[model samples]
Target: MSRRPPDGEAPVVTAIVVAFDSAHALPDCLDALRGEGIATIVVDNASTDDSAALSERRGARVIRNGRNEGYGRANNTGVRAADTEFVLIVNPDVIVQKGAVAALVDAAQRYPDAGFFAPQIVEPSGRVFFQPRSLLAKHLTNPGGKLVLPEGEACAPFFSGACFLMRRSFFLDLGGFDEKIFLFYEDDDLCRRIADTGAALIYVPQARVGHGRGRSSGPKPGLVFKSRWHQAWSRAYVSRKYGLPDPAPSMFAVNALKTLAAGLSFRRSLIERYGGSAAGALAFLRGRSALRQEGLS
Candidate 1:
């Protein structure tokens, strides 16, 4: 990520863009930021393409990584470089609609106690992305009663990191994101940590961003295995971190059963698609091993 001196004299919001070979969809995103009173920084994670040059030409301060650092680390670099009161962490493949950025800034003021906040995240197909909280938050009590979907009208436990605004100091103090996370589950981990600090994580219904879903995960059996494996690992980590007070062993047992069943089903899909039952089984085994290697069990 790039670093810059915060302009002490004026109120300037710095928008941090984390990109990895993200040239195709950047122009429309930059166009949306036109006239927005915010300085922009783009951290290119070792893109072999012209993404860095394009970002620089589009008036964004660009930082080029030597190789593809994982997502959390790249964003952490941007957070360290932030010099403004707030940092807007936006993904390269997302497009911010009108007033979305401003709405997030205003949300910080409206919910003064919230440490992290996100806008309504809509996929390109208009489906809302509901990144679930830890197992305790989801069950512990009931199913979907306390949970708010589509748009959250109140303080939420977790906020999607795809597009969100957060105070720089608070974000820094919370230690940003866990670099251990390669891709999936970083956002949920951050939100869980922030909420543990007694700082609310809120959702601003007015703010909105459109996501080209699965930009990082290509539509392939390997991608599915890897993504699901990582997510399962992260969920276990979060649960272990926060769900200790509860009957965690029992809860984990329940989830483990479900995950095992799902894994079996997914492995069958892999066998059918790849036409190599042995290789597919091996890939599935690797996915399960990844979860275990990450200490999920």
Candidate 2:
């Protein structure tokens, strides 16, 4: 049952889900948000599937884009359309658990200085995914650190882009996610900016959500290539933007060699992965636009 706010009180949060070809997982995501009485806006990034229609039928206001606007830009569109004080940015693969939205709102009320509030994300197997580390640690060191679940509300350097609640005014004031980044690392950039402003990125263990990782886009080869390409491009872009060590030079060389080897072996998948990485790095080195023309077919 959907719970309404007290009489004379306005709704506190609106959920924003940016959809590509996400019809498969969108229904459950919308259902979960509706169950919490949260108004949702589905920003359809020119999905060829029935994502927009399904969202509208499920009672979410749908914003249809003419073309794929990538993740950050589409989210910015949704955030701008929302009227609530706080905005819940959720991926189509994430199911916001019962009371999770309420918990995030309560945390926001308690931590007035926080710009972002993230819930504990669990996998289907019940494994908690909570890896919080500084930008330097992420780039300079091995990122596969031990996972220690937070006992309570904890301050994090950065939260996953999968799901989070953020102050609407603060988000807009910061210009939302950097549109220069087509995909990936947008969260890191946002968190860094929030931290620079002396605002907190709080992780509330009381709130939980189930994340079906990488389910937003289907397993098409072109989509996979696009993801890998953007991952490398965005990583290099963020590193350079923040004055971190440039990974492009080394990444390009290593991935180029790997791609050549994979080509010789006729390993199609490896070739795609390594070739995409190499191309992305070279693009970054050449100062090419991050928003490439290639997109999902």
Please tell me which predicted candidate would have the highest TM-score against the true structure: 2
Off by over 4 Å in 1: 1-9, 131-133, 136-152, 216-229, 243-297
Model 1, span 128-201: residue lDDT tens: 77654544453223354454474355666666778888899998988888876656668877876787778887
Which regions in candidate 2 have their CA more than 4 angstroms from the true location? 6-9, 134-144, 292-297
The lDDT for every candidate, in the order shown, is 0.67, 0.87
Residues 1-297 of candidate 2 have per-residue lDDT tens digits of 125688898888989999998999998999999888989999999898899999999999999999988899999999999998999999999999898988998999998978899999998888888764655333323366656777889887878989999989999999999998888889888988887888888999889999998898656656656677888898999998889999999989999999999999999999889988998889889988677544432
TM-score of 1: 0.73
